[model samples]
Target: MPSTDFQESSSSPSSFNLSILSRRRDQVHSMDSPPLESNGQQSDLEAFQRTVAERFQDLAAAPSEELLSIPWIRKLLDTFLCVHEEFRLIVFNHKSSLAKPPMDKYITDFFERSVKALDVCNAIRDGIEQIRHWQKQLEIVLCALDNQRSIGEGQFRRAKKALIDLTIAMLDERDSNTTVSHRNRSFGRQSNSRAEPRSMANFRSLSWSVSRTWSAARQLQAISSNLAPPRGNEISATNGLNVGVFTMSYVLLFVMWALVAAIPCQDRGLPTHLFTRQFAWAAPIGSLYERIMEESKRRDRRNTCGLMREIYEIEKCVRLMNELTDCVEFPLTEERERQVKQRVQEIGKIYEAIKEGLDPLERLVREVFRRIVRSRTEGLDSIARANLQD
Candidate 1:
């Protein structure tokens, strides 16, 4: 092609592609060159391009910090935190892909925030476990306390009944049969008993009362050992809830944790699964809360029956306890003073047993409490030191 030919074609640059046929064809295209875009489809396309340019200009001019503060824009940051740590890392790939520095400020910010979020999540998890441990312990303790209380009440009843029965027997001696009338009646004389009294005047009656008391106690223990608890999840669960620890955990984990770990997860992988699985575990925190309420009703039913059995056992024990309180020096009527001395010895033996058993339980509880306290105290101390350093 001639130099003139190239110049003619270049004159209509928009139509230069069609110059394959003729140079004169290019001149004709120049004469018919489209006017600067105004109305119709051409203008609409031009306007769209201008709008795109303006958007880019505005984006460049905007302050990054202020832009990030936008509710719509801040959503991106929220997504970063709520996501699983692994998911976020994989999706964004850190700053390793950077040209030279390989350390992205944005990526580092995400790392720090994610770690903080995970820490918060862990704190929330531990808080829940602590609450659970305490609550379960509370159940066992309350049950034991209730058992102890039953024992106390039963003792009181036995003491009163014994007083009444003894008084009745002592007063109603005249209504006895021939054997009692012969054994203790003073041969129609008003002398002190040469033989044993009908009630507890001698060795045999005293021994018999002691035997009866022991027998009654054994029977009660047998009954209690066989007694079954209420067979429902209600009382057991509600008792668990009354622990008060669950509520505190709810506030910390659900309300506070949601705020801290609301990062989005766009990737799918094992790490992402771990994040989601961890979050899924949180579902129990919310869902089982309803179960806590249901537990209330169930507990009432089961406990009512259970409580009765426990109370009855305590009653029987208290009765036996009173009978055994003072050893029989043959009989209460014949020698109350001597019997009381023997009872003191028995009580001493029991007190020693109680102390030994209580020691281990007390020590275990103390150890658990100490560990929790130490961990918390150390954490608070570290936080204070960090603030001071800052």
Candidate 2:
């Protein structure tokens, strides 16, 4: 039951914290008063660190059976969006200082990293569509076998054909490097010919889908490249704002990496070396990463389309059902009939899980995509205004 809404509640503690931060920011901007105390700034930065550490700790503490499941992934996105909102507010409070030398560079770099993540979001949406396609095939199998008084060769043949189609579709997804753009899919609203000529509008137009050769693994590498922690001197110079920027950068990288890990994407790869032990959030993030990587390396999980628990279940049930059908005789013994029903029952359960979870998960991803777009657009605008006033 993780909350999926992107907006923070007005009565929430974070909202109260934001109001306090806003008042502090206003005081610092007053021409009649001296600058705000450094202690106030330090405390704000500390709160941000603690919030991130606590959220990821909760995620990492999930039981092994629940880890990487659909609900778990939804919770992970919820964490990212919450932390991201807090980070966005922190940047707003410090906007006057953002146009300065090193802080400017740090903020600019974080935006660049965020831009890369937009592509990841689009790729993930396509990946979700890919799963939906597989779901349709599962539904076909269910229709062929479910609710029958007694199983027959015709029913078995129909179910087997759907299973075979599902197998081929999944294998093609894992092996094919072709652009998913050909599917004409996107999470964004339909572009209007008369819309404003804004940068974000143009960005949406061009990036509604990934290019033919676009690789999720390579995009992740681009985001992680040169993403080192801010040094002590840099932190001192930026009044610890650099640390926030770096923290958001790493969060962006890790979240996108986890999405690619859980969903089918072009050229999927997990780069384990991107994480570091320097931050409090690192341990939980790293723990989750290791668990997923181990899951990927499992004998049965190898060559699979994704590491999602539902996807794994689907594969297992399909295989068992397929095997049972292949060994069927025209006159099914009572025990053999029971076994077929058991296999069908297993598939039915998985089908129900996918049916219930897939739409909600896709909606969460769409929210993630929209939140990233809105944040980036607002941030870049804020930076431009800051530069102008300076």
Candidate 3:
């Protein structure tokens, strides 16, 4: 079987490479023939984490320190940290899931998927290091010009060359990972591999909840289709409208449920709900049925007008994102900075509008959960009261 573990290499980059270097160093240190000290490897990881945190703080505290004040740079660092943390968690969980040493081919393929995730992190780290190094070189150039010294033409050229090289390497890494991901998807389809979870929570309880919630949501949609209004029916138009509203509300609730199921994948903090007193709850089907009844009584109600309106709003927001993507391209020119800022603001506006629609959906789901808990509490109290009377 292909090695399920990350391969240990003889050489490791000192400062520029964070993700791969750390992993490589850890592997080498742990697998020394004589098995020296393990604490050293742990300390290395700790120091690397501290360095990354310090660098982030420095940039955040004084953005003026960097030669270029680009918003995307900060975004890049933030995204890198998020992905690195997630990949780390996945690796930790994967190791814990193993029964013993000598992982099977299936597990090895899973590890390869994780390595691709780490490859992206490594590229991000390399790009950040290049930017910081260039910033330092730019400062040196400024000082040389001020003091009337030789402009250090040789060093400046080298820095520029290094930056270009790093950019190319990063792009190549991304492209390679994309190709691997496509190949894996094709292989998975051929092999009939397990489907990817809707939520990427590493824990079994949370993962199971996510899978169940997603499955239920999809099943609800399928079932609701059969409940659709009959064509050329003898039924009154108002009754048809009521049925349509009823179906629409169920569809909305299921969609909301699916999004809730996905929260653990997007935000790892949500997994605590699985272990804590909190339970996964969604908007009650009964409440939606009641809303359908009320909405059907309204005169202006026709087909799924409200649902269609929400869909239109969602599409408009999607168009805004597409425009932003089109406006922002690679090979960062001077004009790209202004475009990045403008498009970022446009994205923020679109995010807020989408949040407006989603917030109510999430709130309704939570309210349903609260009602379930409350009713359970009340039932327990009534049983206690009856026991006392007895």
**What is the overall TM-score of model 1 with all chains considered together?**
0.19
Clash count for each candidate, listed in order shown = 15, 0, 0
RMSD of 3: 27.3
Off by over 4 Å in 1: 1-278, 283-292, 299-365
**TM-score of each candidate?**
0.19, 0.82, 0.24
- Tell me how candidate 2 scores on lDDT: 0.74
lDDT leader: 2
Residue 345, candidate 2: Cα error in Å is 1.2
Name the weakest run of 10 consecutive residues (lDDT summed) in model 2.
Answer: 184-193
What lDDT tens digits, residue by residue, belong to model 1 across residues 252-306? 2222222212111111001011111111122222222222223223433221111
**TM-score for predicted model 3 compared with the true structure:** 0.24
| Whole-model lDDT per candidate | 0.27, 0.74, 0.30
Candidate 3 at 305: error in angstroms?
22
Q: Which residues of candidate 3, in runs, are more than 4 Å off?
A: 1-208, 211-214, 217-334, 351-363, 376-390
- Model 2, position 98, has a per-residue lDDT of 74
lDDT of 2 by residue, 1-390 (tens): 012221223332333223223343444456454444376676777788768877887897789788878899999999999999998888777787777887888888888888889899888887777788788888888898788888788877888899988876765665443332222211111122232235433533464377657877778889998999876545556766877788888888989988888887776774456677666666667677777777777888766777889888988988888788788888789999888888888888888888898888888888888888888888878888988998
